[model samples]
Target: MHTSPLITIQAITKSFKGVKAVDNLTLSVGYNEYVALLGPNGAGKTTLVEMIEGLQKPDSGSITIQGKTWQKDAAFLRTIMGISLQETKFTDKMTVSEVLDLFGSFYKLGKKVTRQILQTIRLEEKAKAYVVTLSGGQRQKLALGVAMLNNPQLLLLDEPTTGLDPNARREIWDILMQLKKERGTSMILTTHYMEEAAYLCDRIVIIDKGKILADDTLATLLTSYDPGEVIAFQVSSPLATNSLYEIRGVKDVHWIEEGVKGMLTVESITHTLPVLLNLVESSGNTITSFESRKKTLDDLFRTMTGRSLHE
Candidate 1:
């Protein structure tokens, strides 16, 4: 592996009918590192990855793999880059092993390597299984395995766990981490799940509407928000939520449990405690339980965007 960034995208912009889908986007993935490209729908992440994969060309700027432009050396880049898209299409009649063999043929994978990949992906038993008979998770693993058939230097995965159950998701994460440790493959992945991004990504890049909103280590970006504390209480009465919102220094009050319960985020817990106590006194809203905690990424995103990431 090169002792440098595996991929470099410099001010890349792609347009569709004069509308820029990827707006002057600049990103890089270093050798043996993993990064997450996270954004809501229409964030231009997929378009950007497509450009890097040479499925499309940028209107401006450049994409390079190990200092060689994708335009100049598409075949060489293809040898080093492995991509697993949001969806994988295979011949319905192909068995797991047969399908893998097809990809291996293209990449010229050795028998020893193909055998290892099957085992690495836990598809050894599914070798005789037809691709169409596999579950969503199984097919996903197969898709990933096919992508890695070349023993790629870089892996790009787009929403690899979108339709997986919790167990399957965790299983995929284990496999990915294994690949990271054993192969030292640089990776760039796109996903909408913040929790997944937090756990898998060495660095997270948050984007929206073709522009970057935040990009850094999760902890570093989270610290950019206010250091406010929060205490969520279950209100015993209907009027409590709005009453708490009226308290001083309370920026936003959310009725997380509807009228009977809520979470209030405030400036300073010490100063806000008296305000909350006073509100409880005047509104006669009983508190059944309470919890206090520091600011979090979810809250920070909500504060800035006026909507949760899921929203």
Candidate 2:
């Protein structure tokens, strides 16, 4: 038997002031799949999300959720979709429970559902706390709780943990992971944090200038687009950058500090490292610092786009 994807976007294009924000993009999300939409600022990630969320209409092509178009099935679609934007504001005077209760009422949900959502978001203790008194992370959890009230099958989170500290961010991740494990929720997350996307999403789609540059599992993207171990080292003295490329398995060399500090993308560190060290020693340049690690999504993004995710 064959099953359709949870959401389908077909060659959708959107423009603003004669500038295309999303240029003939096509994408899909499967049932229970968690996808991360990663790109730099003005990359049209938000624009694409807005169209999916029914907040914007594309100039051309179509978007369908569970094979239903937003133009015709919006009423039914709204019931199955949950959205947590980059920032959600609550009345400062409203308690956490009250906030959830208010949103839940829109769906005609009962107190029982509110209790469960509070527990699911790990904010039961803060149920009585006012929104103004809650921490930034707690507020985000509340926003997530509100989004989850409908028991939505699809979740859309836009930079949900952008400003939180590491500990706070992990808390959000834990809650999201729980949702995926327990309820099999499909999700589309837009974020600037490579680690967050790497940790949470099963598939990553990197978009730039309203176009998808790379889309695949993290490991596959690394291996297919730019495969190699990264060797970053600092030397005691300058050396010819071109000479490093002569080593076997060395694919690319980037000089962070001209000839003194450099990084190498090599097919095999075992083959390249020894030769690199010998060359440096023979050239009378002592190694000051060295690190070798597997190439990461951040490295892949830089290779494809020539810019960092945050940039």
Candidate 3:
């Protein structure tokens, strides 16, 4: 509900040689908002983040963090912002405490990263352990702790939970939620995990091929762009595709054949299930199994981008 913009990208365009990487991209993150930058590989997400981080300059446009542009306030911005990249490689010889101390020293007015920060990241017990001895999840938590050592107002997290096990990922999510609640820290997250974005983000900005595909809250996006449910069923015999198309209120019907059995996807489950079942029964076909689910981020992504997230 905070209306003040904490981060803004205005008319941003970045190119490599002759090809555009980010085309006229305009995005903003409000104070205390959690926004996700979602896209597939080669979708200009990295390029856009790099521009915001000031690691790469855009071909044309402007980026401001907390009403200050990088060119005019690079040093001051570093104090107010924290960035955690996808992969952080720390010295194997350093203990967790040593790593935190090292990062904390870089800021002029950085908060003293104490045992509480370690406990917050759930790494207090591992404080004395060497960096190389930590598991992937622990290392990631430590990296997050380092990013937050300065007690930044804006946190930029890039794929924070990628490559983590479910339990480990959930731990990170809990920590993030705790931070959001306790500190009201604004965050801009870049991730491919749809469920993570849905659960953690207030708004999702979907980018593809250097363009913004959709920018809105998940509920709004799903309800407006993708409505209804998908009912799937397995049959003992191949379903008559022609008869499926005749079901009243059915938006679309698709099926897959596996030897003598088949699976179908019907868009209108509530309106078509009863009629479709009767029609299949009358046609001498038996349904072996059935399931139905509301349309999710996967379906919406495929609908917009013409491919799955992995592709």
Q: What ranges in model 3 sit over 4 Å off?
A: 1-4, 17-19, 108-112, 236-242, 254-268, 286-289
Candidate 1 lDDT for residue 308 = 67
The local lDDT score (0 to 100) that residue 69 gets in candidate 1 is: 81
In the order shown, the candidates' Cα RMSDs to the true structure are: 3.0, 1.6, 2.7
Clashes per candidate (backbone, < 3 Å)? 0, 0, 0
Considering lDDT, which of the candidate structures 2 and 3 is the better prediction for this target? 2
TM-score of each candidate structure, all chains considered together: 0.87, 0.95, 0.89
Segments of candidate 2 deviating more than 4 angstroms:
none
In angstroms, how far off is 38's CA in candidate 3? 1.9
Candidate 1 — worst ten consecutive residues by lDDT sum?
235-244
In model 2, the clashing pairs are none
Instruction: State the lDDT of candidate 1 residue by residue for 21-118, as single tens digits.
Output: 88988888888888988876777888988888888888889888888887688789899888998878888798998888878988877667778889
lDDT tens digits by residue: candidate 2, 1-311: 22989999999999999889999999999998999999998999999998999999999989989889888999999999999887788999999999999999999999999999999889989999999999888898888899899999999998899888998899889988988999999999999998998899999999999999988998788888888899999999898978998998998888889899988999999989999999999998899999999998877877887666766
CA lDDT, every prediction? 0.81, 0.91, 0.82
Which numbered prediction scores highest in TM-score against the true structure?
2
The residue-level lDDT of candidate 1 at 180 comes to 88
| Number of the predicted model whose lDDT against the real structure is largest | 2
